[model samples]
Structure formats: structure tokens, C-alpha cells
Target: MRSIQRLVTLGAAAAAVVVLGACSAPSQEPSSATDVPPVPTVAAAGPTTPAVPGSTTAAEVFGPGCASLPTGDDPGSLSSMRLQPVAAAVETNPELTTLNDLIGRANLAGPLNAAPELTVFAPTNDAFAKLPAEQRAALEADPARLATVLEYHVSGTRASAEELRAAGTSTELAGGQVRIGGTGDAMTVSDASGGTANVVCGNVPTGNATVFLIDTVLVPQA
Candidate 1:
């Protein structure tokens, strides 16, 4: 009986060892998880400004002659000129009297006022007055010839001083072209005949056009 009891106790001990082994997990090294790459960061862009169209560049009105123009509601003033069409605006400025008369003689007043957009390289009264009397009278006598000459001073599209510089050349309504050279007050407009003119007043806005008062009259190519 003592031998049988000892055998039974040994069997229980063996069973307990098996149960403990089964309940506990086997010793194992921790798993090394995959190393995920970090997401890339992006930066935002800055805002872009739009370019102005034609003479509407609205950049600024400047030039030596700008100082002489009247201020406020006077039609000749830059502010007031902006309110009138090209032809009507021309009538208000004393300096533009000769130009206005030439426009009438050329039968261009109607066309000028009707234009949707334009850039006029207008000669000051002195420019016209400086011409030989005979030549001026001859030009005035022939309206058709005067029209061509007047149209030569006009560009189909409006351009500011900087715009003219950027383009290097401008096409005229008369089918001719002018070469632009220099910057600001030094800027020069050279015709096909080699005649060059300097802009006195620039960025003078009309309801439908921009005018640059030049010191010399430009002629188209023959």
C-alpha cells in the first residue's frame, strides 16, 4: 500500500508539471515591426498679379508736361480727360488746339471718338507751328494727305511708356511703324524718314484712348 501511494503522488506531480507547461507560453524574442516611412510635407505657393491690358496699364501718369495740366474738373486735366472720349478730350486742352484742328481737317474726329481703343502720339501745338508755313498750308489744303499723316501718329492699340519700351516698335493705323528707343523722358519715337520725336506728356488718358504728347510730328513712309 505504501508503494502504490508513492506512485500516485509521482503521477500527480507529473500531471501538474504538464498543466503548468501547457498554461504558460514558451519564451520568445519580441517581433521587430515594420518601420513605416513618414509622409512628405508640401509648401504653398504665393499669389500672382495680373498684367494690365493696353493703355489701361493704369500704371501712372507722368512726364515733364504733366505739371502744366490743370487739376480737378477741368476737361484738360488728366482726371477730367479720363471722362471724355479722345476727340472731346482733345478739345479741352489749350496745348492740343492745333491737334484738334488737324483732326477736323483730316476728317478724323468722328473715327477717333468712335475708336474702342487707341494710343495717340499727339504733336503739341508747337510741333505743328514749327513746320514751314508753306508745308503746313499745303498739308492742310489736302485733307486726304493730312489724314494719312495724322493717322501715322495713331496706333491701333493703346500702350503706356513701359509697354512701348517692351514692344520696341509700334504699328500705326496708317500701315506704318515707329521704333521706340530709350527710357522715360529720354524715350524717342523714330519714323521711317529718320525723324525722331520725344514724348512731353505721357499716360494722358481719354475715355477711349491714351495720348503721349510728342514734340515732333511723325510722317509715314512714302
Candidate 2:
């Protein structure tokens, strides 16, 4: 009877141990991997500013002629003009009719179109009209001379209004230096002849060049 009781007690203890071991055992089923929250993805930072093809920022259209500029809907606006080459861009502006004609006559349209980058100081029709009759006749009579005069208005690089203001001077294709002055809307460009032309509408971007519409034709020194 004592042996039987001891055997029974041992059997009970073994059964309890088995129950506790079963309770403490780790779960065998697959973990809830799908139920777990996923780590969040981070996005990369963008450039502080995406650079426009020409000009630092959208230019503030200025001067007396600003009123005459094409409205936002017009095809002649800077946005639309930039799609065309410099010569074609100038041709679209009625205010620059004289300059456009001269460009055509001088056969400078080709060169201007071909140039990778340029800054053209385009004189208005009024500017050309202001030139002495003799000077106009001489230019019309001499295509080569007219071409040189036209070249005087161009820089080999794209020069925006801010750039011109910062540089204060730019060498023209005609081998003459043009002096730039003032800040912002008051910017001016002086030719070798000491004549100053106000940049009426500046930072005009075109396909091949940046154009600054001026009030006077730039004349190169002899």
C-alpha cells in the first residue's frame, strides 16, 4: 500500500510537470508577420529650385513699353516667344519692326539663329527712326557695315538683366565693350559711342538667346 501510494504521488507530480511545460511552451503557429505594421518609407529631397532655361526667374516686364506687351494670352509674350529663335522672336514684336527688318537685310538672322547662346540688345523701331537719315542710308547701302552694327548689340553668352547688372560690362561680338549700369528695372547699357540705351523690356528669353529690348541702337567705336 505504501509503495502504491508513492507510485501514485510520483505519477501525479509527473503529470503536473507535463501540464506546466505545455503551458510555458512557445507558440508553434506562424508569427503574425502580415499583421505587423510596416516600416514607413522616406522620400528624397528635391532641389531648392529647379532652374529655368534662361533668366534666373520669370522677368518683371518693365518700361513705358510694358503696357504694350502682349497679355498672358497673347502668342508674343515671353513664354511663347522663347519657343522661337531670336530672329523669329524679334519679328513677332511689332515694336521691334525696324530691328527685325535690319536683321533680315544684314542676313544676321542666320547667325543669330545658329548661335548656341547670345544676348541681343534689340533696338526698337523708334530707336532706328531716331538715327540720322545719312547713317540709315549708309547702313542700308552697306550690308557688311550693317551686319557689324547689328553684331555690336550681341554678346557671345546669355546675359540676363541680373547678370548684366552684376557683370557691369559685356564684350560684344563686334569687338566692343558695352557698359551696363543700374539695378533691377533701371538697368541701362551704354555703347562704345557713349550713347546709353535703357533696357525697356529686359531678360526676354528666346530659343537661342536672351534678348534685352533697348531704346537706342548700339554703335561700335571705329
Candidate 3:
């Protein structure tokens, strides 16, 4: 009877070891496909947006004459041109030689240099050349009259392309009104005598003021 009991106890111990071994073993069953998490998708980059229509940019203010402007490295360039005052800046441009001569003769260069925030509508040499010889001589002979004519070309306030367009008319130091018309490359300025000048080069910034090189000399009414 005792021998039979020992055999039964040994069989029970063997069955418990098998159960423990199965429990301790790693899982062999395959995982479900849904058990893994999905990865997030990345978005592709897009192109830049363009500028708004009808808006005036800095390039627009420079006008078409900028095509003839010297590069920054050139001594004659507008970038180098700004290093000096307006009077000195004008002297650097070969095209404005006549204007420079007139400014010096009239003794207006000193005053122009001293003036703050002035907008000068400088006429090219061709403009002065277009004037009748007798009239030109008479004006040149009289410094006071020449000064008046020169002052008529200047405004106390600095006028940009957009400002001139918005104003339509600007009051000058000569106590006369200058009519500003058109937009962009077609912009024109009219003096008291109804003579109009095309802005060849607009918005040339200097140390003291902005300069617009016009194609015609502006004459104030007597």
C-alpha cells in the first residue's frame, strides 16, 4: 500500500513541473495586424506667394531711367552719389553740368546744401540748352532772378513718386504750385507757365533731400 502511494505522489510532482515550464516559456502565437500603431504622414512644401497687384514697389519708384544708372561700384552711381550733399551730388552727374553751373552762379548751392528735406526737380543740360539764348543770358546775368527760377524747382517737403501722385500739386519755395500728373514711367510735372517736364530720373535720394531729374527747366510766372 505504501509503495502504491509513493508512485502516485511522484506522478503528481512530474505534472506540476510540466505546467510550470509551459507558463515560463515565451509566447509563440503571432500578433494581430491591428495591434501595431500607424505612422503619421509628412506634408510636402509649397511655392512662395506673389506680390499684390497695383501695388508700387521700390523698383517702380526708381523709374525707367534707372536702366542708365551706374552700378554701386561705379563712382558715378546713385549709391556713391548720396555720399555728398544734393549740390555736390548734382555736380557728379555729367548730364547735369548746366544745372550745376546755374546753381553755382546763382549762389544757391550753399543754401540748397543747408536746406533740410528738400525735393529738387533738377533740369538736365538739354533743358537749359532748349531755352532761348536771350532769355538764358538775361537770367544768368541777374543772380536774383536766377535764384528765383532755381528755387521754383524745389519743394520744402521731400516728395516721393507716390506722394507726388497723391498730392497732384505741390507748393514750391518760390510760392508757386507745381502740377504733378500721371503714374509710373509716364509721370509729368507742370510749372506755373503751363510748361510740362517729364521725370527722367525720379526719387534719387541724397544726404539732405530727394532729387528728380526732369527733362525741362521749370519757369515760375512773373
Candidate 4:
């Protein structure tokens, strides 16, 4: 009877072992298909935004544009011919003082300022003094003669040295052509009488005219 009991206990132990092994076995296996990368897609096109246009800027004017028009601090910018830059130029240049006075006497102040543009060939004081005393006395007595002689030096346009070179002849207000000659600083001009006026000072711009201080007076043509 003891042997029969022992055999039954061994059979019970073997059954428990089999049950534990069944519980330890895996229920699922790993997937065989590898994860594929997501497929790339093209970006969709959209309506483009319009660009802004560019703008233009206006010119700026500073201070007083007409500051040089009257009896301002600027010497050569005055509108009155007597008070104009030519006056200052002659006043300051010791050699041209007599010419300055002559201009005043000839009553050229108003006309010079009234003109839109003019070129003046200014003769020096020495040039006038170099004239014979009788001729000088004669000119002083006749204002019209003095005026005509002064007008002979004036052109209707404000011509620069470069402009004078380009055109050999510039018509004078006295109804004759003044011949431009030479080049550079040595440039000279010949009057209708063949007298040469050397350009002592060139391109002196005024409120209404341009002046070139010359060493000799221009003799007008008949």
C-alpha cells in the first residue's frame, strides 16, 4: 500500500512541471516586414504677391535762394549793376578803379542788371589812364560816347572762356563782332580796331552778367 502511495505522489509532481513549462512559452513572434520610409511629396504652388513701386525725390532748396540777389554779404551777387560783382571785382583790383568809376558815370548799372545775361570786357584803370589826356577829357564830357565805348565791351550772352574758344566771334552790344584769340590763360580778344584785350580775370559770374577783367579797352567798329 505504501509503494502505491509513492507512485501517485511522483505522478502529481510530473504534471505540475508540464503545466509550468506551457505557461513560460511565448504567445507572439516579431513582424517580418521592415518599416518603409514615408514617400516624399512635391510642395503645392500658390499665387505670388506683387512688388511695390519706387518713388522719386524732389530737389531741396536751402537758405534763401535770392540771398545773393540784393545788398547781401555776397559781393558779386547783387542785382544792381553798380552794386554787382563786377563793381566788387573792380573795387578790389587797384588797377581797375578808374574803370569802375567810368562804369558808374556811363549809367550802365541799371541796364546790366536788367539784361538776362551779358558778358562784359572790363578795361583796367591803367588802360583808361594810358589814353591821351585830351581824349580822356573829351570822353568824360560826352556821356553817350563813354557809354558807346563801354557797350563795345559788352556781349548779349554770358560767354565762358570755353564758349568763347568754341565760337571765334562774339557779337558786341555796340553792333560789332569781338574776335576771340589764343587759348588757356594766355587767351586774348581783338576789338574791331585790331586792339587786343588780354583776359586778366575770366568767368566772373554776377546776378545777371559775366565779366572778364581785360587789360585794354575795346574799340568799337564804325
Candidate 5:
């Protein structure tokens, strides 16, 4: 196991270098732990189960994307966010900067955080990047349109992974229906935009909502 130990040491050294570089970098809107692009998911230091509704146990968070989050109890970590409102929790998640900024611009964070129960299909920066240029530009340019699009990603009822798969669909806050398919990490969501988004990391939790990081933005239908 000498090679394995060496690899681990090398990995830690590489991570330290990155941390040092980021610490020395110019200030912008402060980001989650690393400035390096994060995979499409939010904070978690470990994996957990996704099928339990209304549970925010740190041990209940799951998905392949979990590994990318910064470890420990920083404001950006899963354990720290377990008691915070969904909108508040997203504020410190690295992969969700684009979504966080849009929510701020659209002024939807208040409603999202205040809602008693919700299931948020949060899109990552990469997801926004993948959005068609004209569509993304239009949404960004108009707060009203952006609000509708953002609402389209949320459900009024909080649902666990099994519940989502069992129901097959949910009505979004935008008053439109979205179809949910697959189970756990393989789950996918489809909206009126006719594009499908995979749930890269499923069953994340906050005080008032269950969060799922999706790989695509869900556009609202007319």
C-alpha cells in the first residue's frame, strides 16, 4: 500500500497548493471553499440516504457529487446548513453561485426561504452555462421572467427520493407541472421547455426544504 499512501499524500499536497493560491487570489464575491469550478452539487463531507422525507440528517445526504464539497462545518458545508432555510443555505454553496445570484436578482430568495415546505431543483453554474445563450440572456435581463423560471424549479411540497419517484410528477411553484423519473442519483426532471435535467446530487436538505442539484435549468411554460 505504499503507492496508495503516496497518492494520498500527493493529493493532499495538491489541495494545499490550490488553497494557498485561492487565498492569494484577488477578492471577488467570496465563493465556496475553492475557486476551482465545483461539480454540480452542494456541500457535504459524507454521503447519506435520500428516501427519508422531512429529515435533514447529515447522514441522509447522498449522490456522487457529494465528494466535491468542502469538508467540515464551514457555512458552506452540509452539516452547517441542515438547520438553515433553503435559500439561506444556497448562499454559501460553491456550485450554485449562478443560481444564488439569479435568486438574488429576481428577489425569490425570500419566498423560497419563507415557504414551509419545498423541494428545490437547484441548477449549478455549469447548468446555467449549458443553457442556450439567447435563453440565458433573456432570463438574466428580465427579473420577472427570471422569477418565473426560478419558481419553475421549486415544488410546494417537500418530497423524499422515493416519494418523488413514486409520484412521478410534481407541480412547481410557477403553477406548472414537472415530470420526475428514475430514482436516487439517476433521477431526472423534465419541464415545459422540453429539456431533461439529471439530478446530479439528490436528497440534500435544509430547514424548510429538500434540495436537489440539477444539471439543467427548468424553463416555465406559457
Candidate 6:
């Protein structure tokens, strides 16, 4: 009878241990990555931003409004309008390559960074390269001349292509005049020397300014 009672107690203990082990097993888990919460994927295809309520990308609709204003296929929303912060703004713009190069050469990047509000008419790499070697050399020799020419493209007000077109002459941040005019859909800017630069892609918005992409570089008249 004593042996039988000990055997029964051992059996009960084993059963309880098994029951407790089964109860402590982890609860049902998601089977796959698909079961996880959605995450925004910024793929190589293009930039991806969080979906905004009632916001639209400029790339979705190409128009004159974006032509003169700082425009880009920015990842962020229009409400914020900042594709990148001030420190990184110039680097992100492919069209501003020449301008950036000049800025680097002139060491004006620091002064530009310090400005409160600025509008830049950024020229393509080809535009600067197109200039006569001697003329560019002369401009390089004179920092003031280089700066003045560069500043001609800059305006205090954030002017879109539409705004620039509407107002023929916009007062530049550097206290010079930037003229605007064109017959067809493509707008042209007449420099102080009556030379015109056609708009390639306009209105690329940055944190501090809008960039109007120009096919030709605007030479400052001294």
C-alpha cells in the first residue's frame, strides 16, 4: 500500500510538471515578415516619404508654378517644403553642380550658409563649362566679380517660375536686377548684359531658398 501511494504521488508530480511546461510555452507569434507592421521603404527607385493627408508631389503634376520656384522630386511633403536641411541643401541638387563648384572655388559657401532667406538660380554643369576660358578665368581672378555674378541669380523672395514670369524684373539679394521674359512655354532670363539664359527645370525648393535651373549661366554686368 505504501509503495502504491509513493508511485501515485510521483505520477501526479510528473503530470503537473508537464502541464506547467506546456503553459509556459511562448504565445502564438507572427509567422512571417509580412505579418509585421508596415514600414516605409526608401528604395533606389526614388525617395519615399510618409504619406501625407491632402499633399501632392510636384513630380505628379509638372507645371509653370514649379518652374521658377525651388522644385525637386523631394521625399518630404509640401507643408515642410524642405528636401534637406541647410547644411546639405546644395549637395542634393544635381542641377546646381556648377554653382556649387563655383561656390566651393570662391569660398562663398560659408556666406551663403549664413544668409536667412535666399533664392538661387542654379545653372547646370554644362552652363559653367560653356563659358569662354579667358572670361571664366577673369571672373575667377576677381572674387567680387564672381560673387556679384552669382548673386544676380539670387533673389530675396522665394519666386517660383510663375512669380518670376509675372514680375519681369526681380530685385536680387545682392541688390541687382534679374530680368525675365520668354514667348513660348520655356521662360528666359535676360542678364544685365542682355544675354538670356533659358530655364531648364525650375522651382526646386530648398530649406532656405528656391532654385531655378538655367541652361546658360547668367553673367553679371559690372
Pairs of residues clashing in candidate 3? none
Instruction: Estimate, for each residue in 55-93, the C-alpha lDDT of model 5 and write its tens digit.
Output: 456665777777776568877678766778888999988
Worst 10 residues of 4 by lDDT: 52-61
Q: Give the Cα error of residue 8 in candidate 5, in Å.
A: 48
Candidate 2 accuracy as lDDT: 0.76
Q: What is the lDDT of residue 5 in candidate 1?
A: 30
Best candidate (score: lDDT): 1
- Roughly what TM-score does model 2 have, to 2 decimal places? 0.74
Residue-level lDDT tens digits of model 1 in 146-193:
888888888867787788989999998777799998786777889989
Model 2, 121: alpha-carbon shift in Å?
A: 0.4
lDDT (0 to 1) per candidate: 0.79, 0.76, 0.75, 0.61, 0.78, 0.61
Query: What global local distance difference test value does model 4 have?
Result: 0.61
Residue-level lDDT tens digits of model 2 in 31-95 = 68676556688889775431444443335455666566676646667767878888888888878
Once fitted onto the true fold, the runs of candidate 1 whose alpha carbons sit more than 4 angstroms away are: 1-52, 56-59
TM-score of candidate 5 versus the correct structure, residues matched by position: 0.73
**Ten-residue stretch with the least lDDT total in model 1:** 1-10
* TM-scores vs. true structure, each candidate: 0.74, 0.74, 0.71, 0.60, 0.73, 0.61
Candidate 2's displacement at residue 90, Å, is: 0.6
TM-score of 3: 0.71
RMSD of 4: 43.1
Candidate 3 lDDT over 1-222, as tens digits, reads 222233335546877899999999997553786676566888886754213222222344465666676776565467766666788888888778999999889877766775545678889888899999999999999988888888889876676777888989888877789999977677899999989999988877776667888889999998
Candidate 1 Cα RMSD after full superposition onto the native fold (Å)? 32.8
Model 5: how far residue 169 lies from native, Å: 0.4
| RMSD list, candidates in order | 32.8, 28.2, 31.9, 43.1, 19.3, 23.1
- Of 2 and 5, the candidate ahead on TM-score is 2
